[model samples]
Target chain A: MKFKAFLTDNGVSLLEKRFLPALDKMGRICHLYLTKDHAFFLHNLLNGDGVQSIAQFRKESLFEDYRISSQNDDRIAFTIDLGLLHRALRSSVSVCGHVTTATNRLQVKLVKKLTHNSQQPMPFLTFESKGYKSAVIQDVPISKPLSRVDVVELQSAIDMAQDLPQTLVQGPDLHQLQSFVDRLKHVGDLLHITITQYGDLHLQLLNTLTTLGVEFRKLPVVGVQAHVPSGDQNMTAQSRTKYAVEKGEALSVQVSLKHFAKSLQCHLTKPDCAFYGITPLASCLTVIFQFFIPGTRQTDKSISLHCRLPVLDPGSA
Target chain B: MSSSEADPDIPDLVCQLDNVQGMVDALSSVRWKRHQDSVLELSEHGIVVIVEESGCLQAKVYLKKELFVSYEYRAEGRPRFGVSLGVFVDCLNTFSVSGRSSSIEICYPGPDMQLLLKSVDTPDACIYAEIRTKVPDTISWDYNFEPAGSTPLSFTVKSAALKEAIDDLEWPGSSIQIVLQPDPPCVQFRGEGHGDLQIDFMYYANTDLLIAFQCDRLVSYRYKYKFLRATTSNMPGSVIKDNRGSKLTIGRGGMLKVQHLVSVARPSTQHPHIDSAAYQQPSRIAYIEFFVKPEVDEEPVNDA
Candidate 1:
């Protein structure tokens, strides 16, 4: 069985600039699972933070072809170093590249040869899975294919993230929001974020010594129907509420001033950035930064970054 | 896109340059470990960063206000605070990606406040860091070397040659020994531990490589490479290639001064609106200096 993605420099930048920031918000490694129609990236962390799954729909126009084996239940999953893979993705100088899994190794081949350099070999980078390697280099980490149970956990995490209630924030410039939170942190380090029933996202810096709060009021809301948001991730949601978020229904999540600031990094590169906050009552809090690949022929090549951070409230702990 | 167009809120301190690598390189001149908790003081002039080791050796790097394309300090008083050096660097590095044009603005409301960095260029991304101001003065080792006055031996040399000479030396030594005299080998650099290895650097009358060489009386000084090594490791190789000449001045009482300009100025002819009178493109020099105190000479004092 073979799965291929015609990786373009844009796609590689998507992996380098966008993908790494999302993982930087979460864990060190991620599991890449490829099915017949789409590529699903799953991360189920052990630190009780929650799970994250980013699904990229196969755009035939952007890709040479995204093909999976026709055999029954042939979905393949392999673990990779999120940071290292990002660097490998960026190492290619070609407009076109190919990512293929064969002989138990995932090879990223930069297929576009530069006309100026005829002496250099066709550049390709490979990642060896523990399942494929007979001997291991001491201390160096070796990635392995995901086990059946690991797949189950990641799928459950994805379903849970989708099943969870998410609030999309608008109106406030992220720079302002970030600065406000950062400033309040000096007085109090623990930041408590709450979404009021009136569609306002309330950010509060709370500690035993001081309490400061800011309310981002009346952010427009999209309809309740659930699917991956429009591919133009940065575009502000224009669809006025045919449905209003339940009033008085507030879900709050507490995080350190540092963690909240670190998670906001993914939005730096995208000018028109959109932020979505996912807080499921009390377990953990997740923030999704969405952006789109600017140019594509037939379809929208969009990416949604989901980062889960532990909600370590002193009272809760 | 320019920073003003990016909608980064009314920045308390907004400064931009063609690139940020020079400031990062300048900061490298200062030692890191001992100065970790020192509050980074921001004034109308620029950031005042003082890095010191034990009460004897110290380095101060000033990211001058002029170097910034635009600098606005809204804070009333001088803001003194310490931020995590590693975390702060990580935020600025986001703009270091290739082909991605970037304009950076650093904003903070007051001292002990959160330091926010917004890059209007690439992806409009921003980084937030929690700066601790309460412990700004925790690193209180202030050594007054008084490097401003006249020195015994002062000379300028190409940064590349000095770096190569240091690199070429068999570094298996405890400390570095430097000797400047009026003899044939005008300047001698030695590395001594298991064995003594010495190299000579010659002076030229007029050349870009060796800008100037001023010799006073004969003098020899020895310093622990460990402290100097920690400081030099931060010099990013990219800036050295810009051919910014370096000058080494050994002052009275083993006080050593190393000064170099690192910024590569875009020609003044290119900027049509640049106030030539107010902003002299040639005067737009980004200089970094390291004042290293020579280690106490352990050799017998009466010996020749």
Candidate 2:
């Protein structure tokens, strides 16, 4: 039977309960790859010299080289034929793998395909007995949503803002402030929905949402700026005996926000300028602009950094 | 699964939980274990005293502690005392379960006649004692010896026993022996009168890893009576019979023999000792001592 990699928790459970047990009962376990967790439990079943059963053989040899870490978005697949499954199951050793099959309605076409290219190509034998019956398996249920919420929210917000006034009688600054607040609330709502609905589904949820369209902007804070040290142009003979020394300083980014209660920097924080060693008056460095969704808040103070101009040691100079 | 349809090979009951009850039944299945060890000592006078070594003829003899020997001439002035000597130890082989039983052997080949050897096996072999000898002044001989033993004895649970209960098997313990003799035999009032002497013993290890020793202590007393002091102005009726010869053997305990086959429950119980985090890290070795006696060279000497 053809096999597929289990991607979801339900899919994994189905593979373990239905597929693995069926294969075990049918005794077709050789040449199967299982996840590390599953292989750990099944390793004791396989038979070989030093290997007690197929489970052990797969666990030691196959899993070591073939088992992929589930942390990555990679898929693993396994395939098995019916005749082999029948022979393996009938053997005394315990067999386990994906998709077990029983041989009842004999077909030469299917039988020949089972033995084709196999390491040991042996003839098929009838494996029917009293109380030996084929195991029945069912597919697991999964649901997929037709549309995402962010797309609807964006469209609705755009349509609702059309009737708002374009004039500045109340004050243009106040009008812009109100518009910005409205957009911020709309974005935050979208973020909450995206995080809740798809967060636990898979690793690709966050990346996928970003690709489809979602954004978070960090709030501005004080940040560091870099500058050369200011000193007296003249130096004593002893001070001049060696090479010149270069120093750096940090400065804060100052910006005027009309609605802000006090003077606020466009930068992430006042601490940012000092972190980079730039002094308050150092204008050599410029504040950088960053874009994010309105819902994103200032998690930390931003820092600006620059290296000190190289100063050569006296002996080297 | 119905009992009738289940594979006949599968036991009627496969109760993983019932194994504990079976273990409780085996609590009384006591298996005995035995242990033994070999001990040897070297005296400053070149005498080797071996106690309950692996086998027979494991003994220690004292020759010269610092190679300083004074001469005492006989009144008749015959063969002088202070003869250079060497003691030879034949073998110190390990005891085998299948081989013929063997014990320690000590020998003294000297000019003097009459030798006496002694041995003792103390319970637990834990006592630390010493043996002293009385001999005339200026007697000397060099010797060497090794301890041999009966086949090494250790306990292992049979496969059948393991299938039932592993705790029924016995475990071994450590073995130790002490030399019951003075440090250097050359000093006055020691075994200074005797020469060409040896001792040996057998070592055994039981289930508890303790070694039991069967040691034989032997002394070779040799002397000659002369008429007068020939070198120092003729004197009559003076005898120069002095203690001059000795030999020694060094025996060490063997490594503990470990069982390789571990039953399911046995591994769960014993593996913790080997698997614990305390032993998982690397550490330094504090100190190590090796005691092995060299064989005697018996090349004939010239009598000028």
Candidate 3:
């Protein structure tokens, strides 16, 4: 197996300042999946507990000269401590001022190091940056590459987690939602999320002594037609409205407040907007963060992050 | 069941206040514990919240009817209920958006006797909460504080300075000794334990720091430092920012009463359209009082 890549200035900033730090908040260790076309940072994908986060970036978006070769179809996957990775990235870029114009270039490669005390070799992801005045190198230890069977299982888990809900509604401002959730933390442990086809989102926190709720109305709906099952002519915009009028019921799911709050940390990336969706059977709540171009409403497809928050049993709530 | 279905003769108690932050500030001042319960008493005049700690420390927050934008009380008599102070304060905090003042409507005895709160403004979005209230148990102890002496031994000091002094003295001892001298017209707080700390406030040195001094004889009493710290620990920032005066009066039997004023004025910036004349009408304020008992074995040192 062989992997080497040179990070662009934009990629350095996004990974060092935004993506890695955000992932660090979610979990201690995250699987870094490298394929021919994309790189993914996945957290708790195989585990049944905790919030599962998948952040995908197109290879060209971050790396200029990317090369990878492996027996398992050129796909490499390994888990690394997110904190160590983030710290390495921060040190590499910060040593050189003005990343855009400085004579600093960061190159990352996978290598095995032989220690004097141990006979076996240990794998490490090394980051080497050469600045005008000094050169900084950081070595982050990583787990051994996954076997072929493990890689297949991981791919299936990623596919299963990518399933979108039938309905998706835009969420409120993240800062406002954050504060509201912080207050709810004082009240209860479980949060009931309700989303309707009519662009209404309601969050409720119920306890033995108090029932607190906040409702946002008239949010813009997204990906309604695409997610609806085929052979349904009523899935059009007008027909959807009519159907909503007929069935005024909404999709509601109960989730742990701690998990929900953990997922909201994605707001640190400063996404232009976010869309929320819940599975019909209350399996999970999906939060998709969308970034927009600086001067336009066009979506920035270079980077994307989505979280699947496991729903708690309604009866237990 | 809606209030309409209830007896029309006895209307439900509903009050609306535009200054949600002011109310939050006053309520949070007395929130010393995370799970403390506060009893609420509502009448035509206003709302009174009483919180007590171990029968040794008691606090009362008086939110007058004038502090709110509208007060509609039709209950025949005062109704009392118990609620968790932490939950109540947090619920009110949600209605107060930073830099923007919002009006909140409060109603009592929801179909199930739940206290209901709803944000009045914000058409697109609305925040609502319902808190369950239990029948209030009769207050454990009600100490009627009478002046300890003829001259009504009391001293008023800057709330910020007083809060700072008490906070600084927390590390020295478990009990704090408060001494007032009539000769030099000064008050001193001394803490003794592993070390000693004494903070003095003289009336003549800086009148602003020691706002008022009225005493005919020297009196000294010792109080639990924990209870004394509770009086100023949770004081809201607005109170300290306003530089309000906190008065500490010694009542009969060494009972110490600490009083603080919290302004519940509707920030004029939020309501630019409202005339200044209405804003100048002596901004309504909330009165908070804390009563702490002196150490049992300590005798008052009287130097007349």
- All DockQ scores: 0.03, 0.00, 0.49
**Cα distance off (Å), candidate 3, residue A65:** 1.7
Model 3 chain B: lowest-lDDT 10 consecutive positions: B1-10
lDDT of 2 by residue, A169-260 (tens): 11112222223223223111211100011011000001211101111111112332122123411432112212122221111221111212
Predictions in order: chain A TM-score: 0.64, 0.14, 0.89
- CA displacement after TM-score superposition, residue A224 of candidate 2 (Å): 62
DockQ of 2: 0.00
- Candidate 3, which segments miss by more than 4 Å at Cα? A95-104, A223-248, A314-317, B1-11, B273-281, B298-304
Top-lDDT structure, candidate number: 3
Judged by lDDT relative to the true structure, which candidate is superior, 2 or 3? 3
Arranged by DockQ with the best first, the candidates are 3, 1, 2
Residue-level lDDT tens digits of model 1 in B92-119:
4433333333356666532334565544
List candidate 1 segments past 4 Å from native. Answer: A1-50, A54-161, A169-275, A279-317, B1-21, B31-35, B39-47, B69-130, B134-152, B204-209, B264-282, B298-304
Candidate 3 lDDT for residue B272: 68
- lDDT of each residue in A262-313, candidate 1, tens digit only: 6665455453554445455555566655454455333244444555656776
* Order of the predicted models by lDDT, top scorer first: 3, 1, 2
In angstroms, the error of model 3 at B227 is: 1.5
Q: Give per-residue CA lDDT, model 2, range B183-276, as digits (tens).
A: 2221111111223112222122122222222223321211111100001111011111111111122232322111111111211233466434
